[model samples]
Target chain A: MSYLKEFTKGLVKENPTLVTLLGMCPTLAITTMASNAIGMGAAATFVLICSNVAISLLKKFIPKQVRLPSYIVVIAGFVTLISLILQAFVPAVYDALGIYLPLITVNCIILGRAEMFASKNNVAASALDGAGMGIGFTLALLAVGSIREILGSGTWFGLPLIPEAAQEAIKPMTIFVLPAGGFFVLGCVIALVNKIANRKPPEATGCAACPNRESCISVEKAESTVENTKKEENK
Target chain B: MNKLFVESSPHIRSAWTTQKIMLNVIIALCPALVMSTYIFGIKALLLTVICCTSCVLFEFAFNKITKREDTISDLSAVVTGMLLAFNLPVDLPVYMAIIGCFVAIVIVKCLFGGIGQNFANPAITARIVLMMSFAGAMTKWTAPFAWKEGVDATVSATPLAAETLPSMTDMFLGFRAGCLGETCIAALLLGGLYLMFIGLIRPATPLCFIGTVAVLSFFYGGCDVNFMLYQLMSGGLILGAFFMATDYATTPLTTKGKIIFGVGCGLITFAIRQYASMPEGVSFSILVMNCLTPLIDRFTAPKALGTVKPKKEGKQ
Candidate 1:
């Protein structure tokens, strides 16, 4: 595959968050604030890149059956390194990230990349894939985080944008900060992205029009088949 | 000019178009609207107008953007707007009321395919959303006639949540703190009776719903008549039973299904009122029942005259 294709695909076409819907726990939890999103994204990116590189370099030595547990170990080591660095230098981000900081070890994106790309590709290609996927995940988190922060808390990155006077006049919909608000904003953002990409929503036509109607033994089909078998036996 | 219009099995037609049904509902709602204006002052009418205008505008805008046929003329959005406003406090900010309308029309109604295609009742769902999101603002109920006398919006407890019950006569005449259109039992009854008379709404669902509430509240109140009457007149029980619970799109289709839906609403409303912290439970109850409408319909569907139910697999 082309090197450019490998790097660009994760940005939109196969976005880790929006397209693949991986790592949802952090995507929903830390996205309450734009700053939190950035911190979480950066931390995850560091871990993902390190883990991908390590896994790719050692791919030949690792046995196929034990690759998953081995990959987790590699991911956990890098996660610990990033977590300790964040805690030592940037205490605020560390506190804000909370339990989610350590959760990077099991973030599906890291493990997914290790299994899907790093295990098969060389170190350089795996690292590039990690960076692209990391950037994609960060952008998605930033989009959701910024929207939720501005509307939910009336601030973006700790800066109060909606003036106090205007806030008095109009209360920002506080629901955006709430969990339900997270769901609503996420749904709208995903819908907007899907629309921009000109994606067709899945059709919800019921079983009557299902494409597998021929082989599927629905109630009507079962009854008809039973009747046919009974008639053949009688004849 | 005697041309035969050949068609499928449904050759017979009725005069009840969507527009006619919605217009009839709007007309039925007029008595309560007028009563609310007199009781709650001009703000009630203003809120109603704002909600109706915005709901239609939102529906229109959504249709324009989505390239669908404009359906605002059918007046369903107007009905949804009126119902939503009726569920809110009269003193609620016009913009908040507009937000509720957006939730009702655009999000709940339109996004779910508009009008008859929605799963839950739009107005009920919007009221719940607003109530949950803006708990303090939504629960601040002003006393009856406070706006007329310029009483600085003295917040008072609703009859349902009040320490001492108001006189039955006052409650009947709607001189109590509650949502704008739900206070006046007489006006709601008149509107409901008119809808029944015009055949716009069947009496089965409303009667069963109100009956269940009355019976349950009576037993729950230790067979006290006055307590049962007070429970019946307070909150949105009358408005929800007569107007919302009878919504054609959300309620069940068959008579048996309607009764089941009504009983379920009554049970939930009773549970919420007696146990939950929230003062009122009518909207939540009706919305919950609306969610179960398909299940109710499926279970209570009328069997065809000559068709036997299919046998079980093990039963030859």
Candidate 2:
């Protein structure tokens, strides 16, 4: 794929969390509420975008030897800025995201993009890559948040979407919102997505079609054996 | 008269096979097997028997019903049965143990394409299921035979009970209140040592696991020695750390990878018991570490004999 297309795909078609399965720490840790997801996503996007842009610009100067340290410094700076901004303006998100917000500096997505795409791409392409990844991360967080909050607390964004009776009955997969739950759910989501993406209908009229036919044949054999056993027993 | 032998296409034979390993584990489990029956009364024996019979029966039936290769003769069913029995509380209802057996053999070992393909330990998964569904019975702890009258019975604290916890010496000595097989550290160690001696198994996995936990606990943990010891002793730790966690299919291959796997189990166990809601973390911790076994193996691959470490990760 071309650099520009690769960059754009990170947005949704190959979103980091939802599609690409990169950077689970932030995806699970910060998405407890919708707002936290937004804040965390914003922090990650800012770092992702800044680091990508800076890495692309500095790609010529830094030797391949020390490029990793240079990228880390740039990413760390952006992460610090996000941390300072949150601490001052939005203490709640700052506190809630806690270790995770700063953890964004090391998130595989930012470092991953810097190493893989940003270092190799032009400034414009790097910027697009960052934005794409940011949007994808945000959307994935929103999906997880929506599912967790609705089920876990019977409320979305502190608003009661559930009726009084339904609220009482809501057993919230209380686990889904926990850090562990985030991972388990994330794993399930990835498996499901893989299943869907790799989904295939019954194969027909191709050489590729019949390789796995033995399992079907075995099923037939099983049925016949059972029938034979029943007939013998009845006699 | 000329006779042609056509059984399993075996041209050469060795004493070792999958069935042999499975039977070895069954034999190793006998000490805990006897201990559990003695402590939990005849019901523990009954449950053990029931689980063994049902697990084998279910495995055979499922293999026939599904027309896959029949697996009961391999003794995996027996391993699952013994492991299931080890996980169950002696006081637990026979039917519950049977359900655990069914789940262990049918769902975990069978449904997931069987044996090696199953993502986690069959017995541990079944234990988790039964622990969740039958919380009350699963946690029923019987006092040691000597202490039943003095401790006031009613599920009194285990010997490894944490700071201000129960008797540490009792836990070390295997006289405590906990799961059927998990209460006795010494006996489990003996069994593990025996397995290691006979060349049936190696100690590289569980020793690193238990050693890491002990070292970490001593250095960083404020939870009392007994509490830590109980953590080691109670709830399938030895059975898992030594036997189940050492599964060749599930655990890593290289020595370095095995150590890393052990360390991962320790860290998770410490983190969960310290931070999470669960007090007993062995089964869950082992299952979690088991999930990472492949990744750990991938990352810490050993330099193969007479070769260099491959850049792509798996071997010299």
Candidate 3:
């Protein structure tokens, strides 16, 4: 595949959060605020790109049986590096992220891309995939974070959007910041994203109607019906 | 030529259609509606109208957009709207109540394939959502008759919060603070009687439900009859037992399952009232039990009468 395709796929077609659904622990936990989301996203992206590059470079030398352990060691090194940097320079975000920052070592997004994409791909392709996926993850976080912050806190980035005089009249829905709110918002976001990406409605029914129907199964039936009609017209 | 109608099931059916059933429920809710207006003033009536209209409108709009047949004619939306409004405080902002109606008709009902298809009671789930999303507004109950004397109706406390418990007669007469429809046990009971008379709901679920709660509270209160009556009268227990816990789609079909469901609801309600921080727990308890209807039905399904039990392995 072209480098552009490799890079661009993760942005939407293969998004880490909304599409692939990796790294949900931090996605749901730390995306309560826009600033926290950005901080966490950027930190995770940094770790992702570095780990992908490291894993790709060492793929030939690393033993096949213990590749998971080696991959974790490499990912952990980058995570610790990121953790120290964030703690030193951005102590506020460090404190806000708390245990989640170090917990990034186990974030499936980083390890997933490292194993699935970087282990087999060339260095440049792996780097581009990492960047694509990182940007995708960051964008997903930003989307969820903005929604939660605006509705739950009446702020976009810790700045009040509703006027102070009107604040008492229009109290924000405080549930969006809580765990249940996070789930509702996440579910809605995923639904919206899926709707946009898959423009064609599933054949003969809605999602709720036939829980057993697979997407491509419907597509296959539709395509074969069309081909049969075309052959009849020719005859 | 003679006409023939082919259908599934036992073939023989009652005259009752979905629309008729829903219309009966709407009629059954009238006593409580009148009582709420009497206690809370004309604002209660206005809120009910707004909620019911918005619910039907939302259902119509959703069906139009989704290209499905309009189900508003069936009157389930109206029933859901009335039930949702009944659980709310009379002083709730109209827009907030409308929002709750939207959650009920659109999210809970329509999204789950509309009437007869939802997994839980739409009104119960919508009330829970509104409770969680807008706790302060949702819980702002004013003193009964406060609206009558033009006394500032901003006082916020239910019967559970009052320093001195209101007299049982006062609570029964809807003179105490509670949800719009729940404060009036007399009205809810009247409605319940009307429903039972019309055969809209069976006595199994409601009777067993209130009975379990009464017995448990009596024992828990050290065999105090007043405490038992107080527990039964307060909260939305009567309203839930009569209207919500008996929802056709959310409750079980078999008699045995309905009894099991009622016992489960009663136990959960007592536990939540006694242990949870929230003063009242009717809607929560009903919603929780609604989640278990399928399981309860499965376990309580009646076996075939003629089927023989299996013999012991050694005997076989």
Candidate 4:
């Protein structure tokens, strides 16, 4: 039950791509085509699972001060391995993914999992977490990629969905293949996911979790000073 | 028998309600609307009606679904629809125009908290989206009055994209191929002047925007006044400068900021037009500047009457 929970949580509750929003570079870049999305997802997932298990196994030996760099080296090694494998076997996807394939070395999802989950957890749990998160990221990419491909190219997985005659009448919007369309689709997908999950805005729990905590805290301080002056005047 | 009503500041109110302002904008747009109809025939008028109706319906539906207050009565959506129609090629399919309307009212406006809260001008953004989606259809311009040829209207490049330029008088009087609303300089100026007269929009942004383009094109064309005039009248420059660039919600508030925004728009437009593959850069430039409006407002915000800047202790 504990192992299953760790695996299932990443599919939805703690989805790295949709919820935590890690690995955005590839999510927005390689999702122009459904096939590219799957290829990229598989590559990233392989790296993620491998790196997670390796990090979890080696965590006791790695010093806390140098853990992050050590994790990067491990992740980079797996990323290179996957990149070479893809380049040798599936050159089409390799060419399509381009620089983004190598860029998986710096993907925040792998490092985030290593630091937050793998580094602290046992090998089994960390591997489960990695597999779950990897699958979640893949699913998210597939959703975004399918939408972009269908609308942008009037096709899915390179098979012509819209008939030729109809395509002439209602040509596919090429913009969906562009970077701007990636953002629009990503936003819509995220919104849909939030709605499906009935996700409410995260409750403010001090400044730690807030992204804009630095600027927000300063504003709060200024506001409090103004309020203090007002109270003094009233007194 | 005097009743005292206590409220915050801005105690004074004006008769310029959202509806009234929208109505005035609609009225100002009438000349260009009329010109497009005349140039493109009944198809232009049909497209406009479809766009306006769909925009209003989309907004109404979105509000109903979200359980928000009905905003359709404000007629802002109507203005957005009309502006969108104006930006489209007259020969575009009705369904595409409706998609543009959905993007304008729903995606760009309602999703961002509706009306006054949208980061970019809804019409401008929707037009760009449509342009990107249907590049072939969007760029397929019909020559003025070519609809008279019955369905097989002679397709022609817009003045900016043409190999040889049309006469200044022809371009000024709106005898050319371009988007429905962008062709006619005369009608657009009439609408712009009316908006300025009604005090709904200040001339600072439009003047600075057009002037910057004029100055840049003059030098770029090696001091040729004719080329400058041609550049000013061509594409969506006049239409965008007078109307979309002056959108209150997406534009800067202060005069200094408005000038900066306008000049920024002009610079981008000029660069794209002169160097870029695309002939028209008005929409892209306006969209870019619209995104920068918040920053412009922040930097140009008026200081409080009695507030003093904090002194740097170490420097002193």
**Residue-level error in angstroms, candidate 4, position B188:** 0.9
Q: Highest TM-score: give the candidate number.
A: 4
Give me the runs in candidate 3 sitting further than 4 Å from their true place: A199-235, B1-12, B304-316
DockQ comparisons of all candidates to the true complex: 0.37, 0.04, 0.48, 0.78
lDDT of 1 by residue, B137-211 (tens): 788888888877888678888888789888999999888888988999999999999999998788888888888
Q: How many residue pairs clash in each candidate?
A: 0, 2, 0, 0
Model 1 chain A: worst 10 consecutive residues (lDDT sum): A208-217
Per-residue lDDT value at B172 in model 3: 90
Q: Once superposed on the true structure, which residue ranges of model 1 sit more than 4 Å away at CA?
A: A84-88, A200-235, B1-12, B219-224, B313-316
How many pairs of residues collide in model 4?
0
TM-score, candidate 2, is 0.55
Q: Which runs in model 2 stand beyond 4 Å of their true positions?
A: A1-235, B1-14, B146-153, B158-169, B221-231, B302-316
- Best-fitting candidate, measured by DockQ? 4
Model 3: what TM-score for its first chain?
0.85
Window of ten residues with lowest summed lDDT in model 4 chain B: B1-10
Which residue segments of model 4 deviate by more than 4 Å? A205-235, B1-12, B306-316
Error of 4 at B165 (Å): 1.5
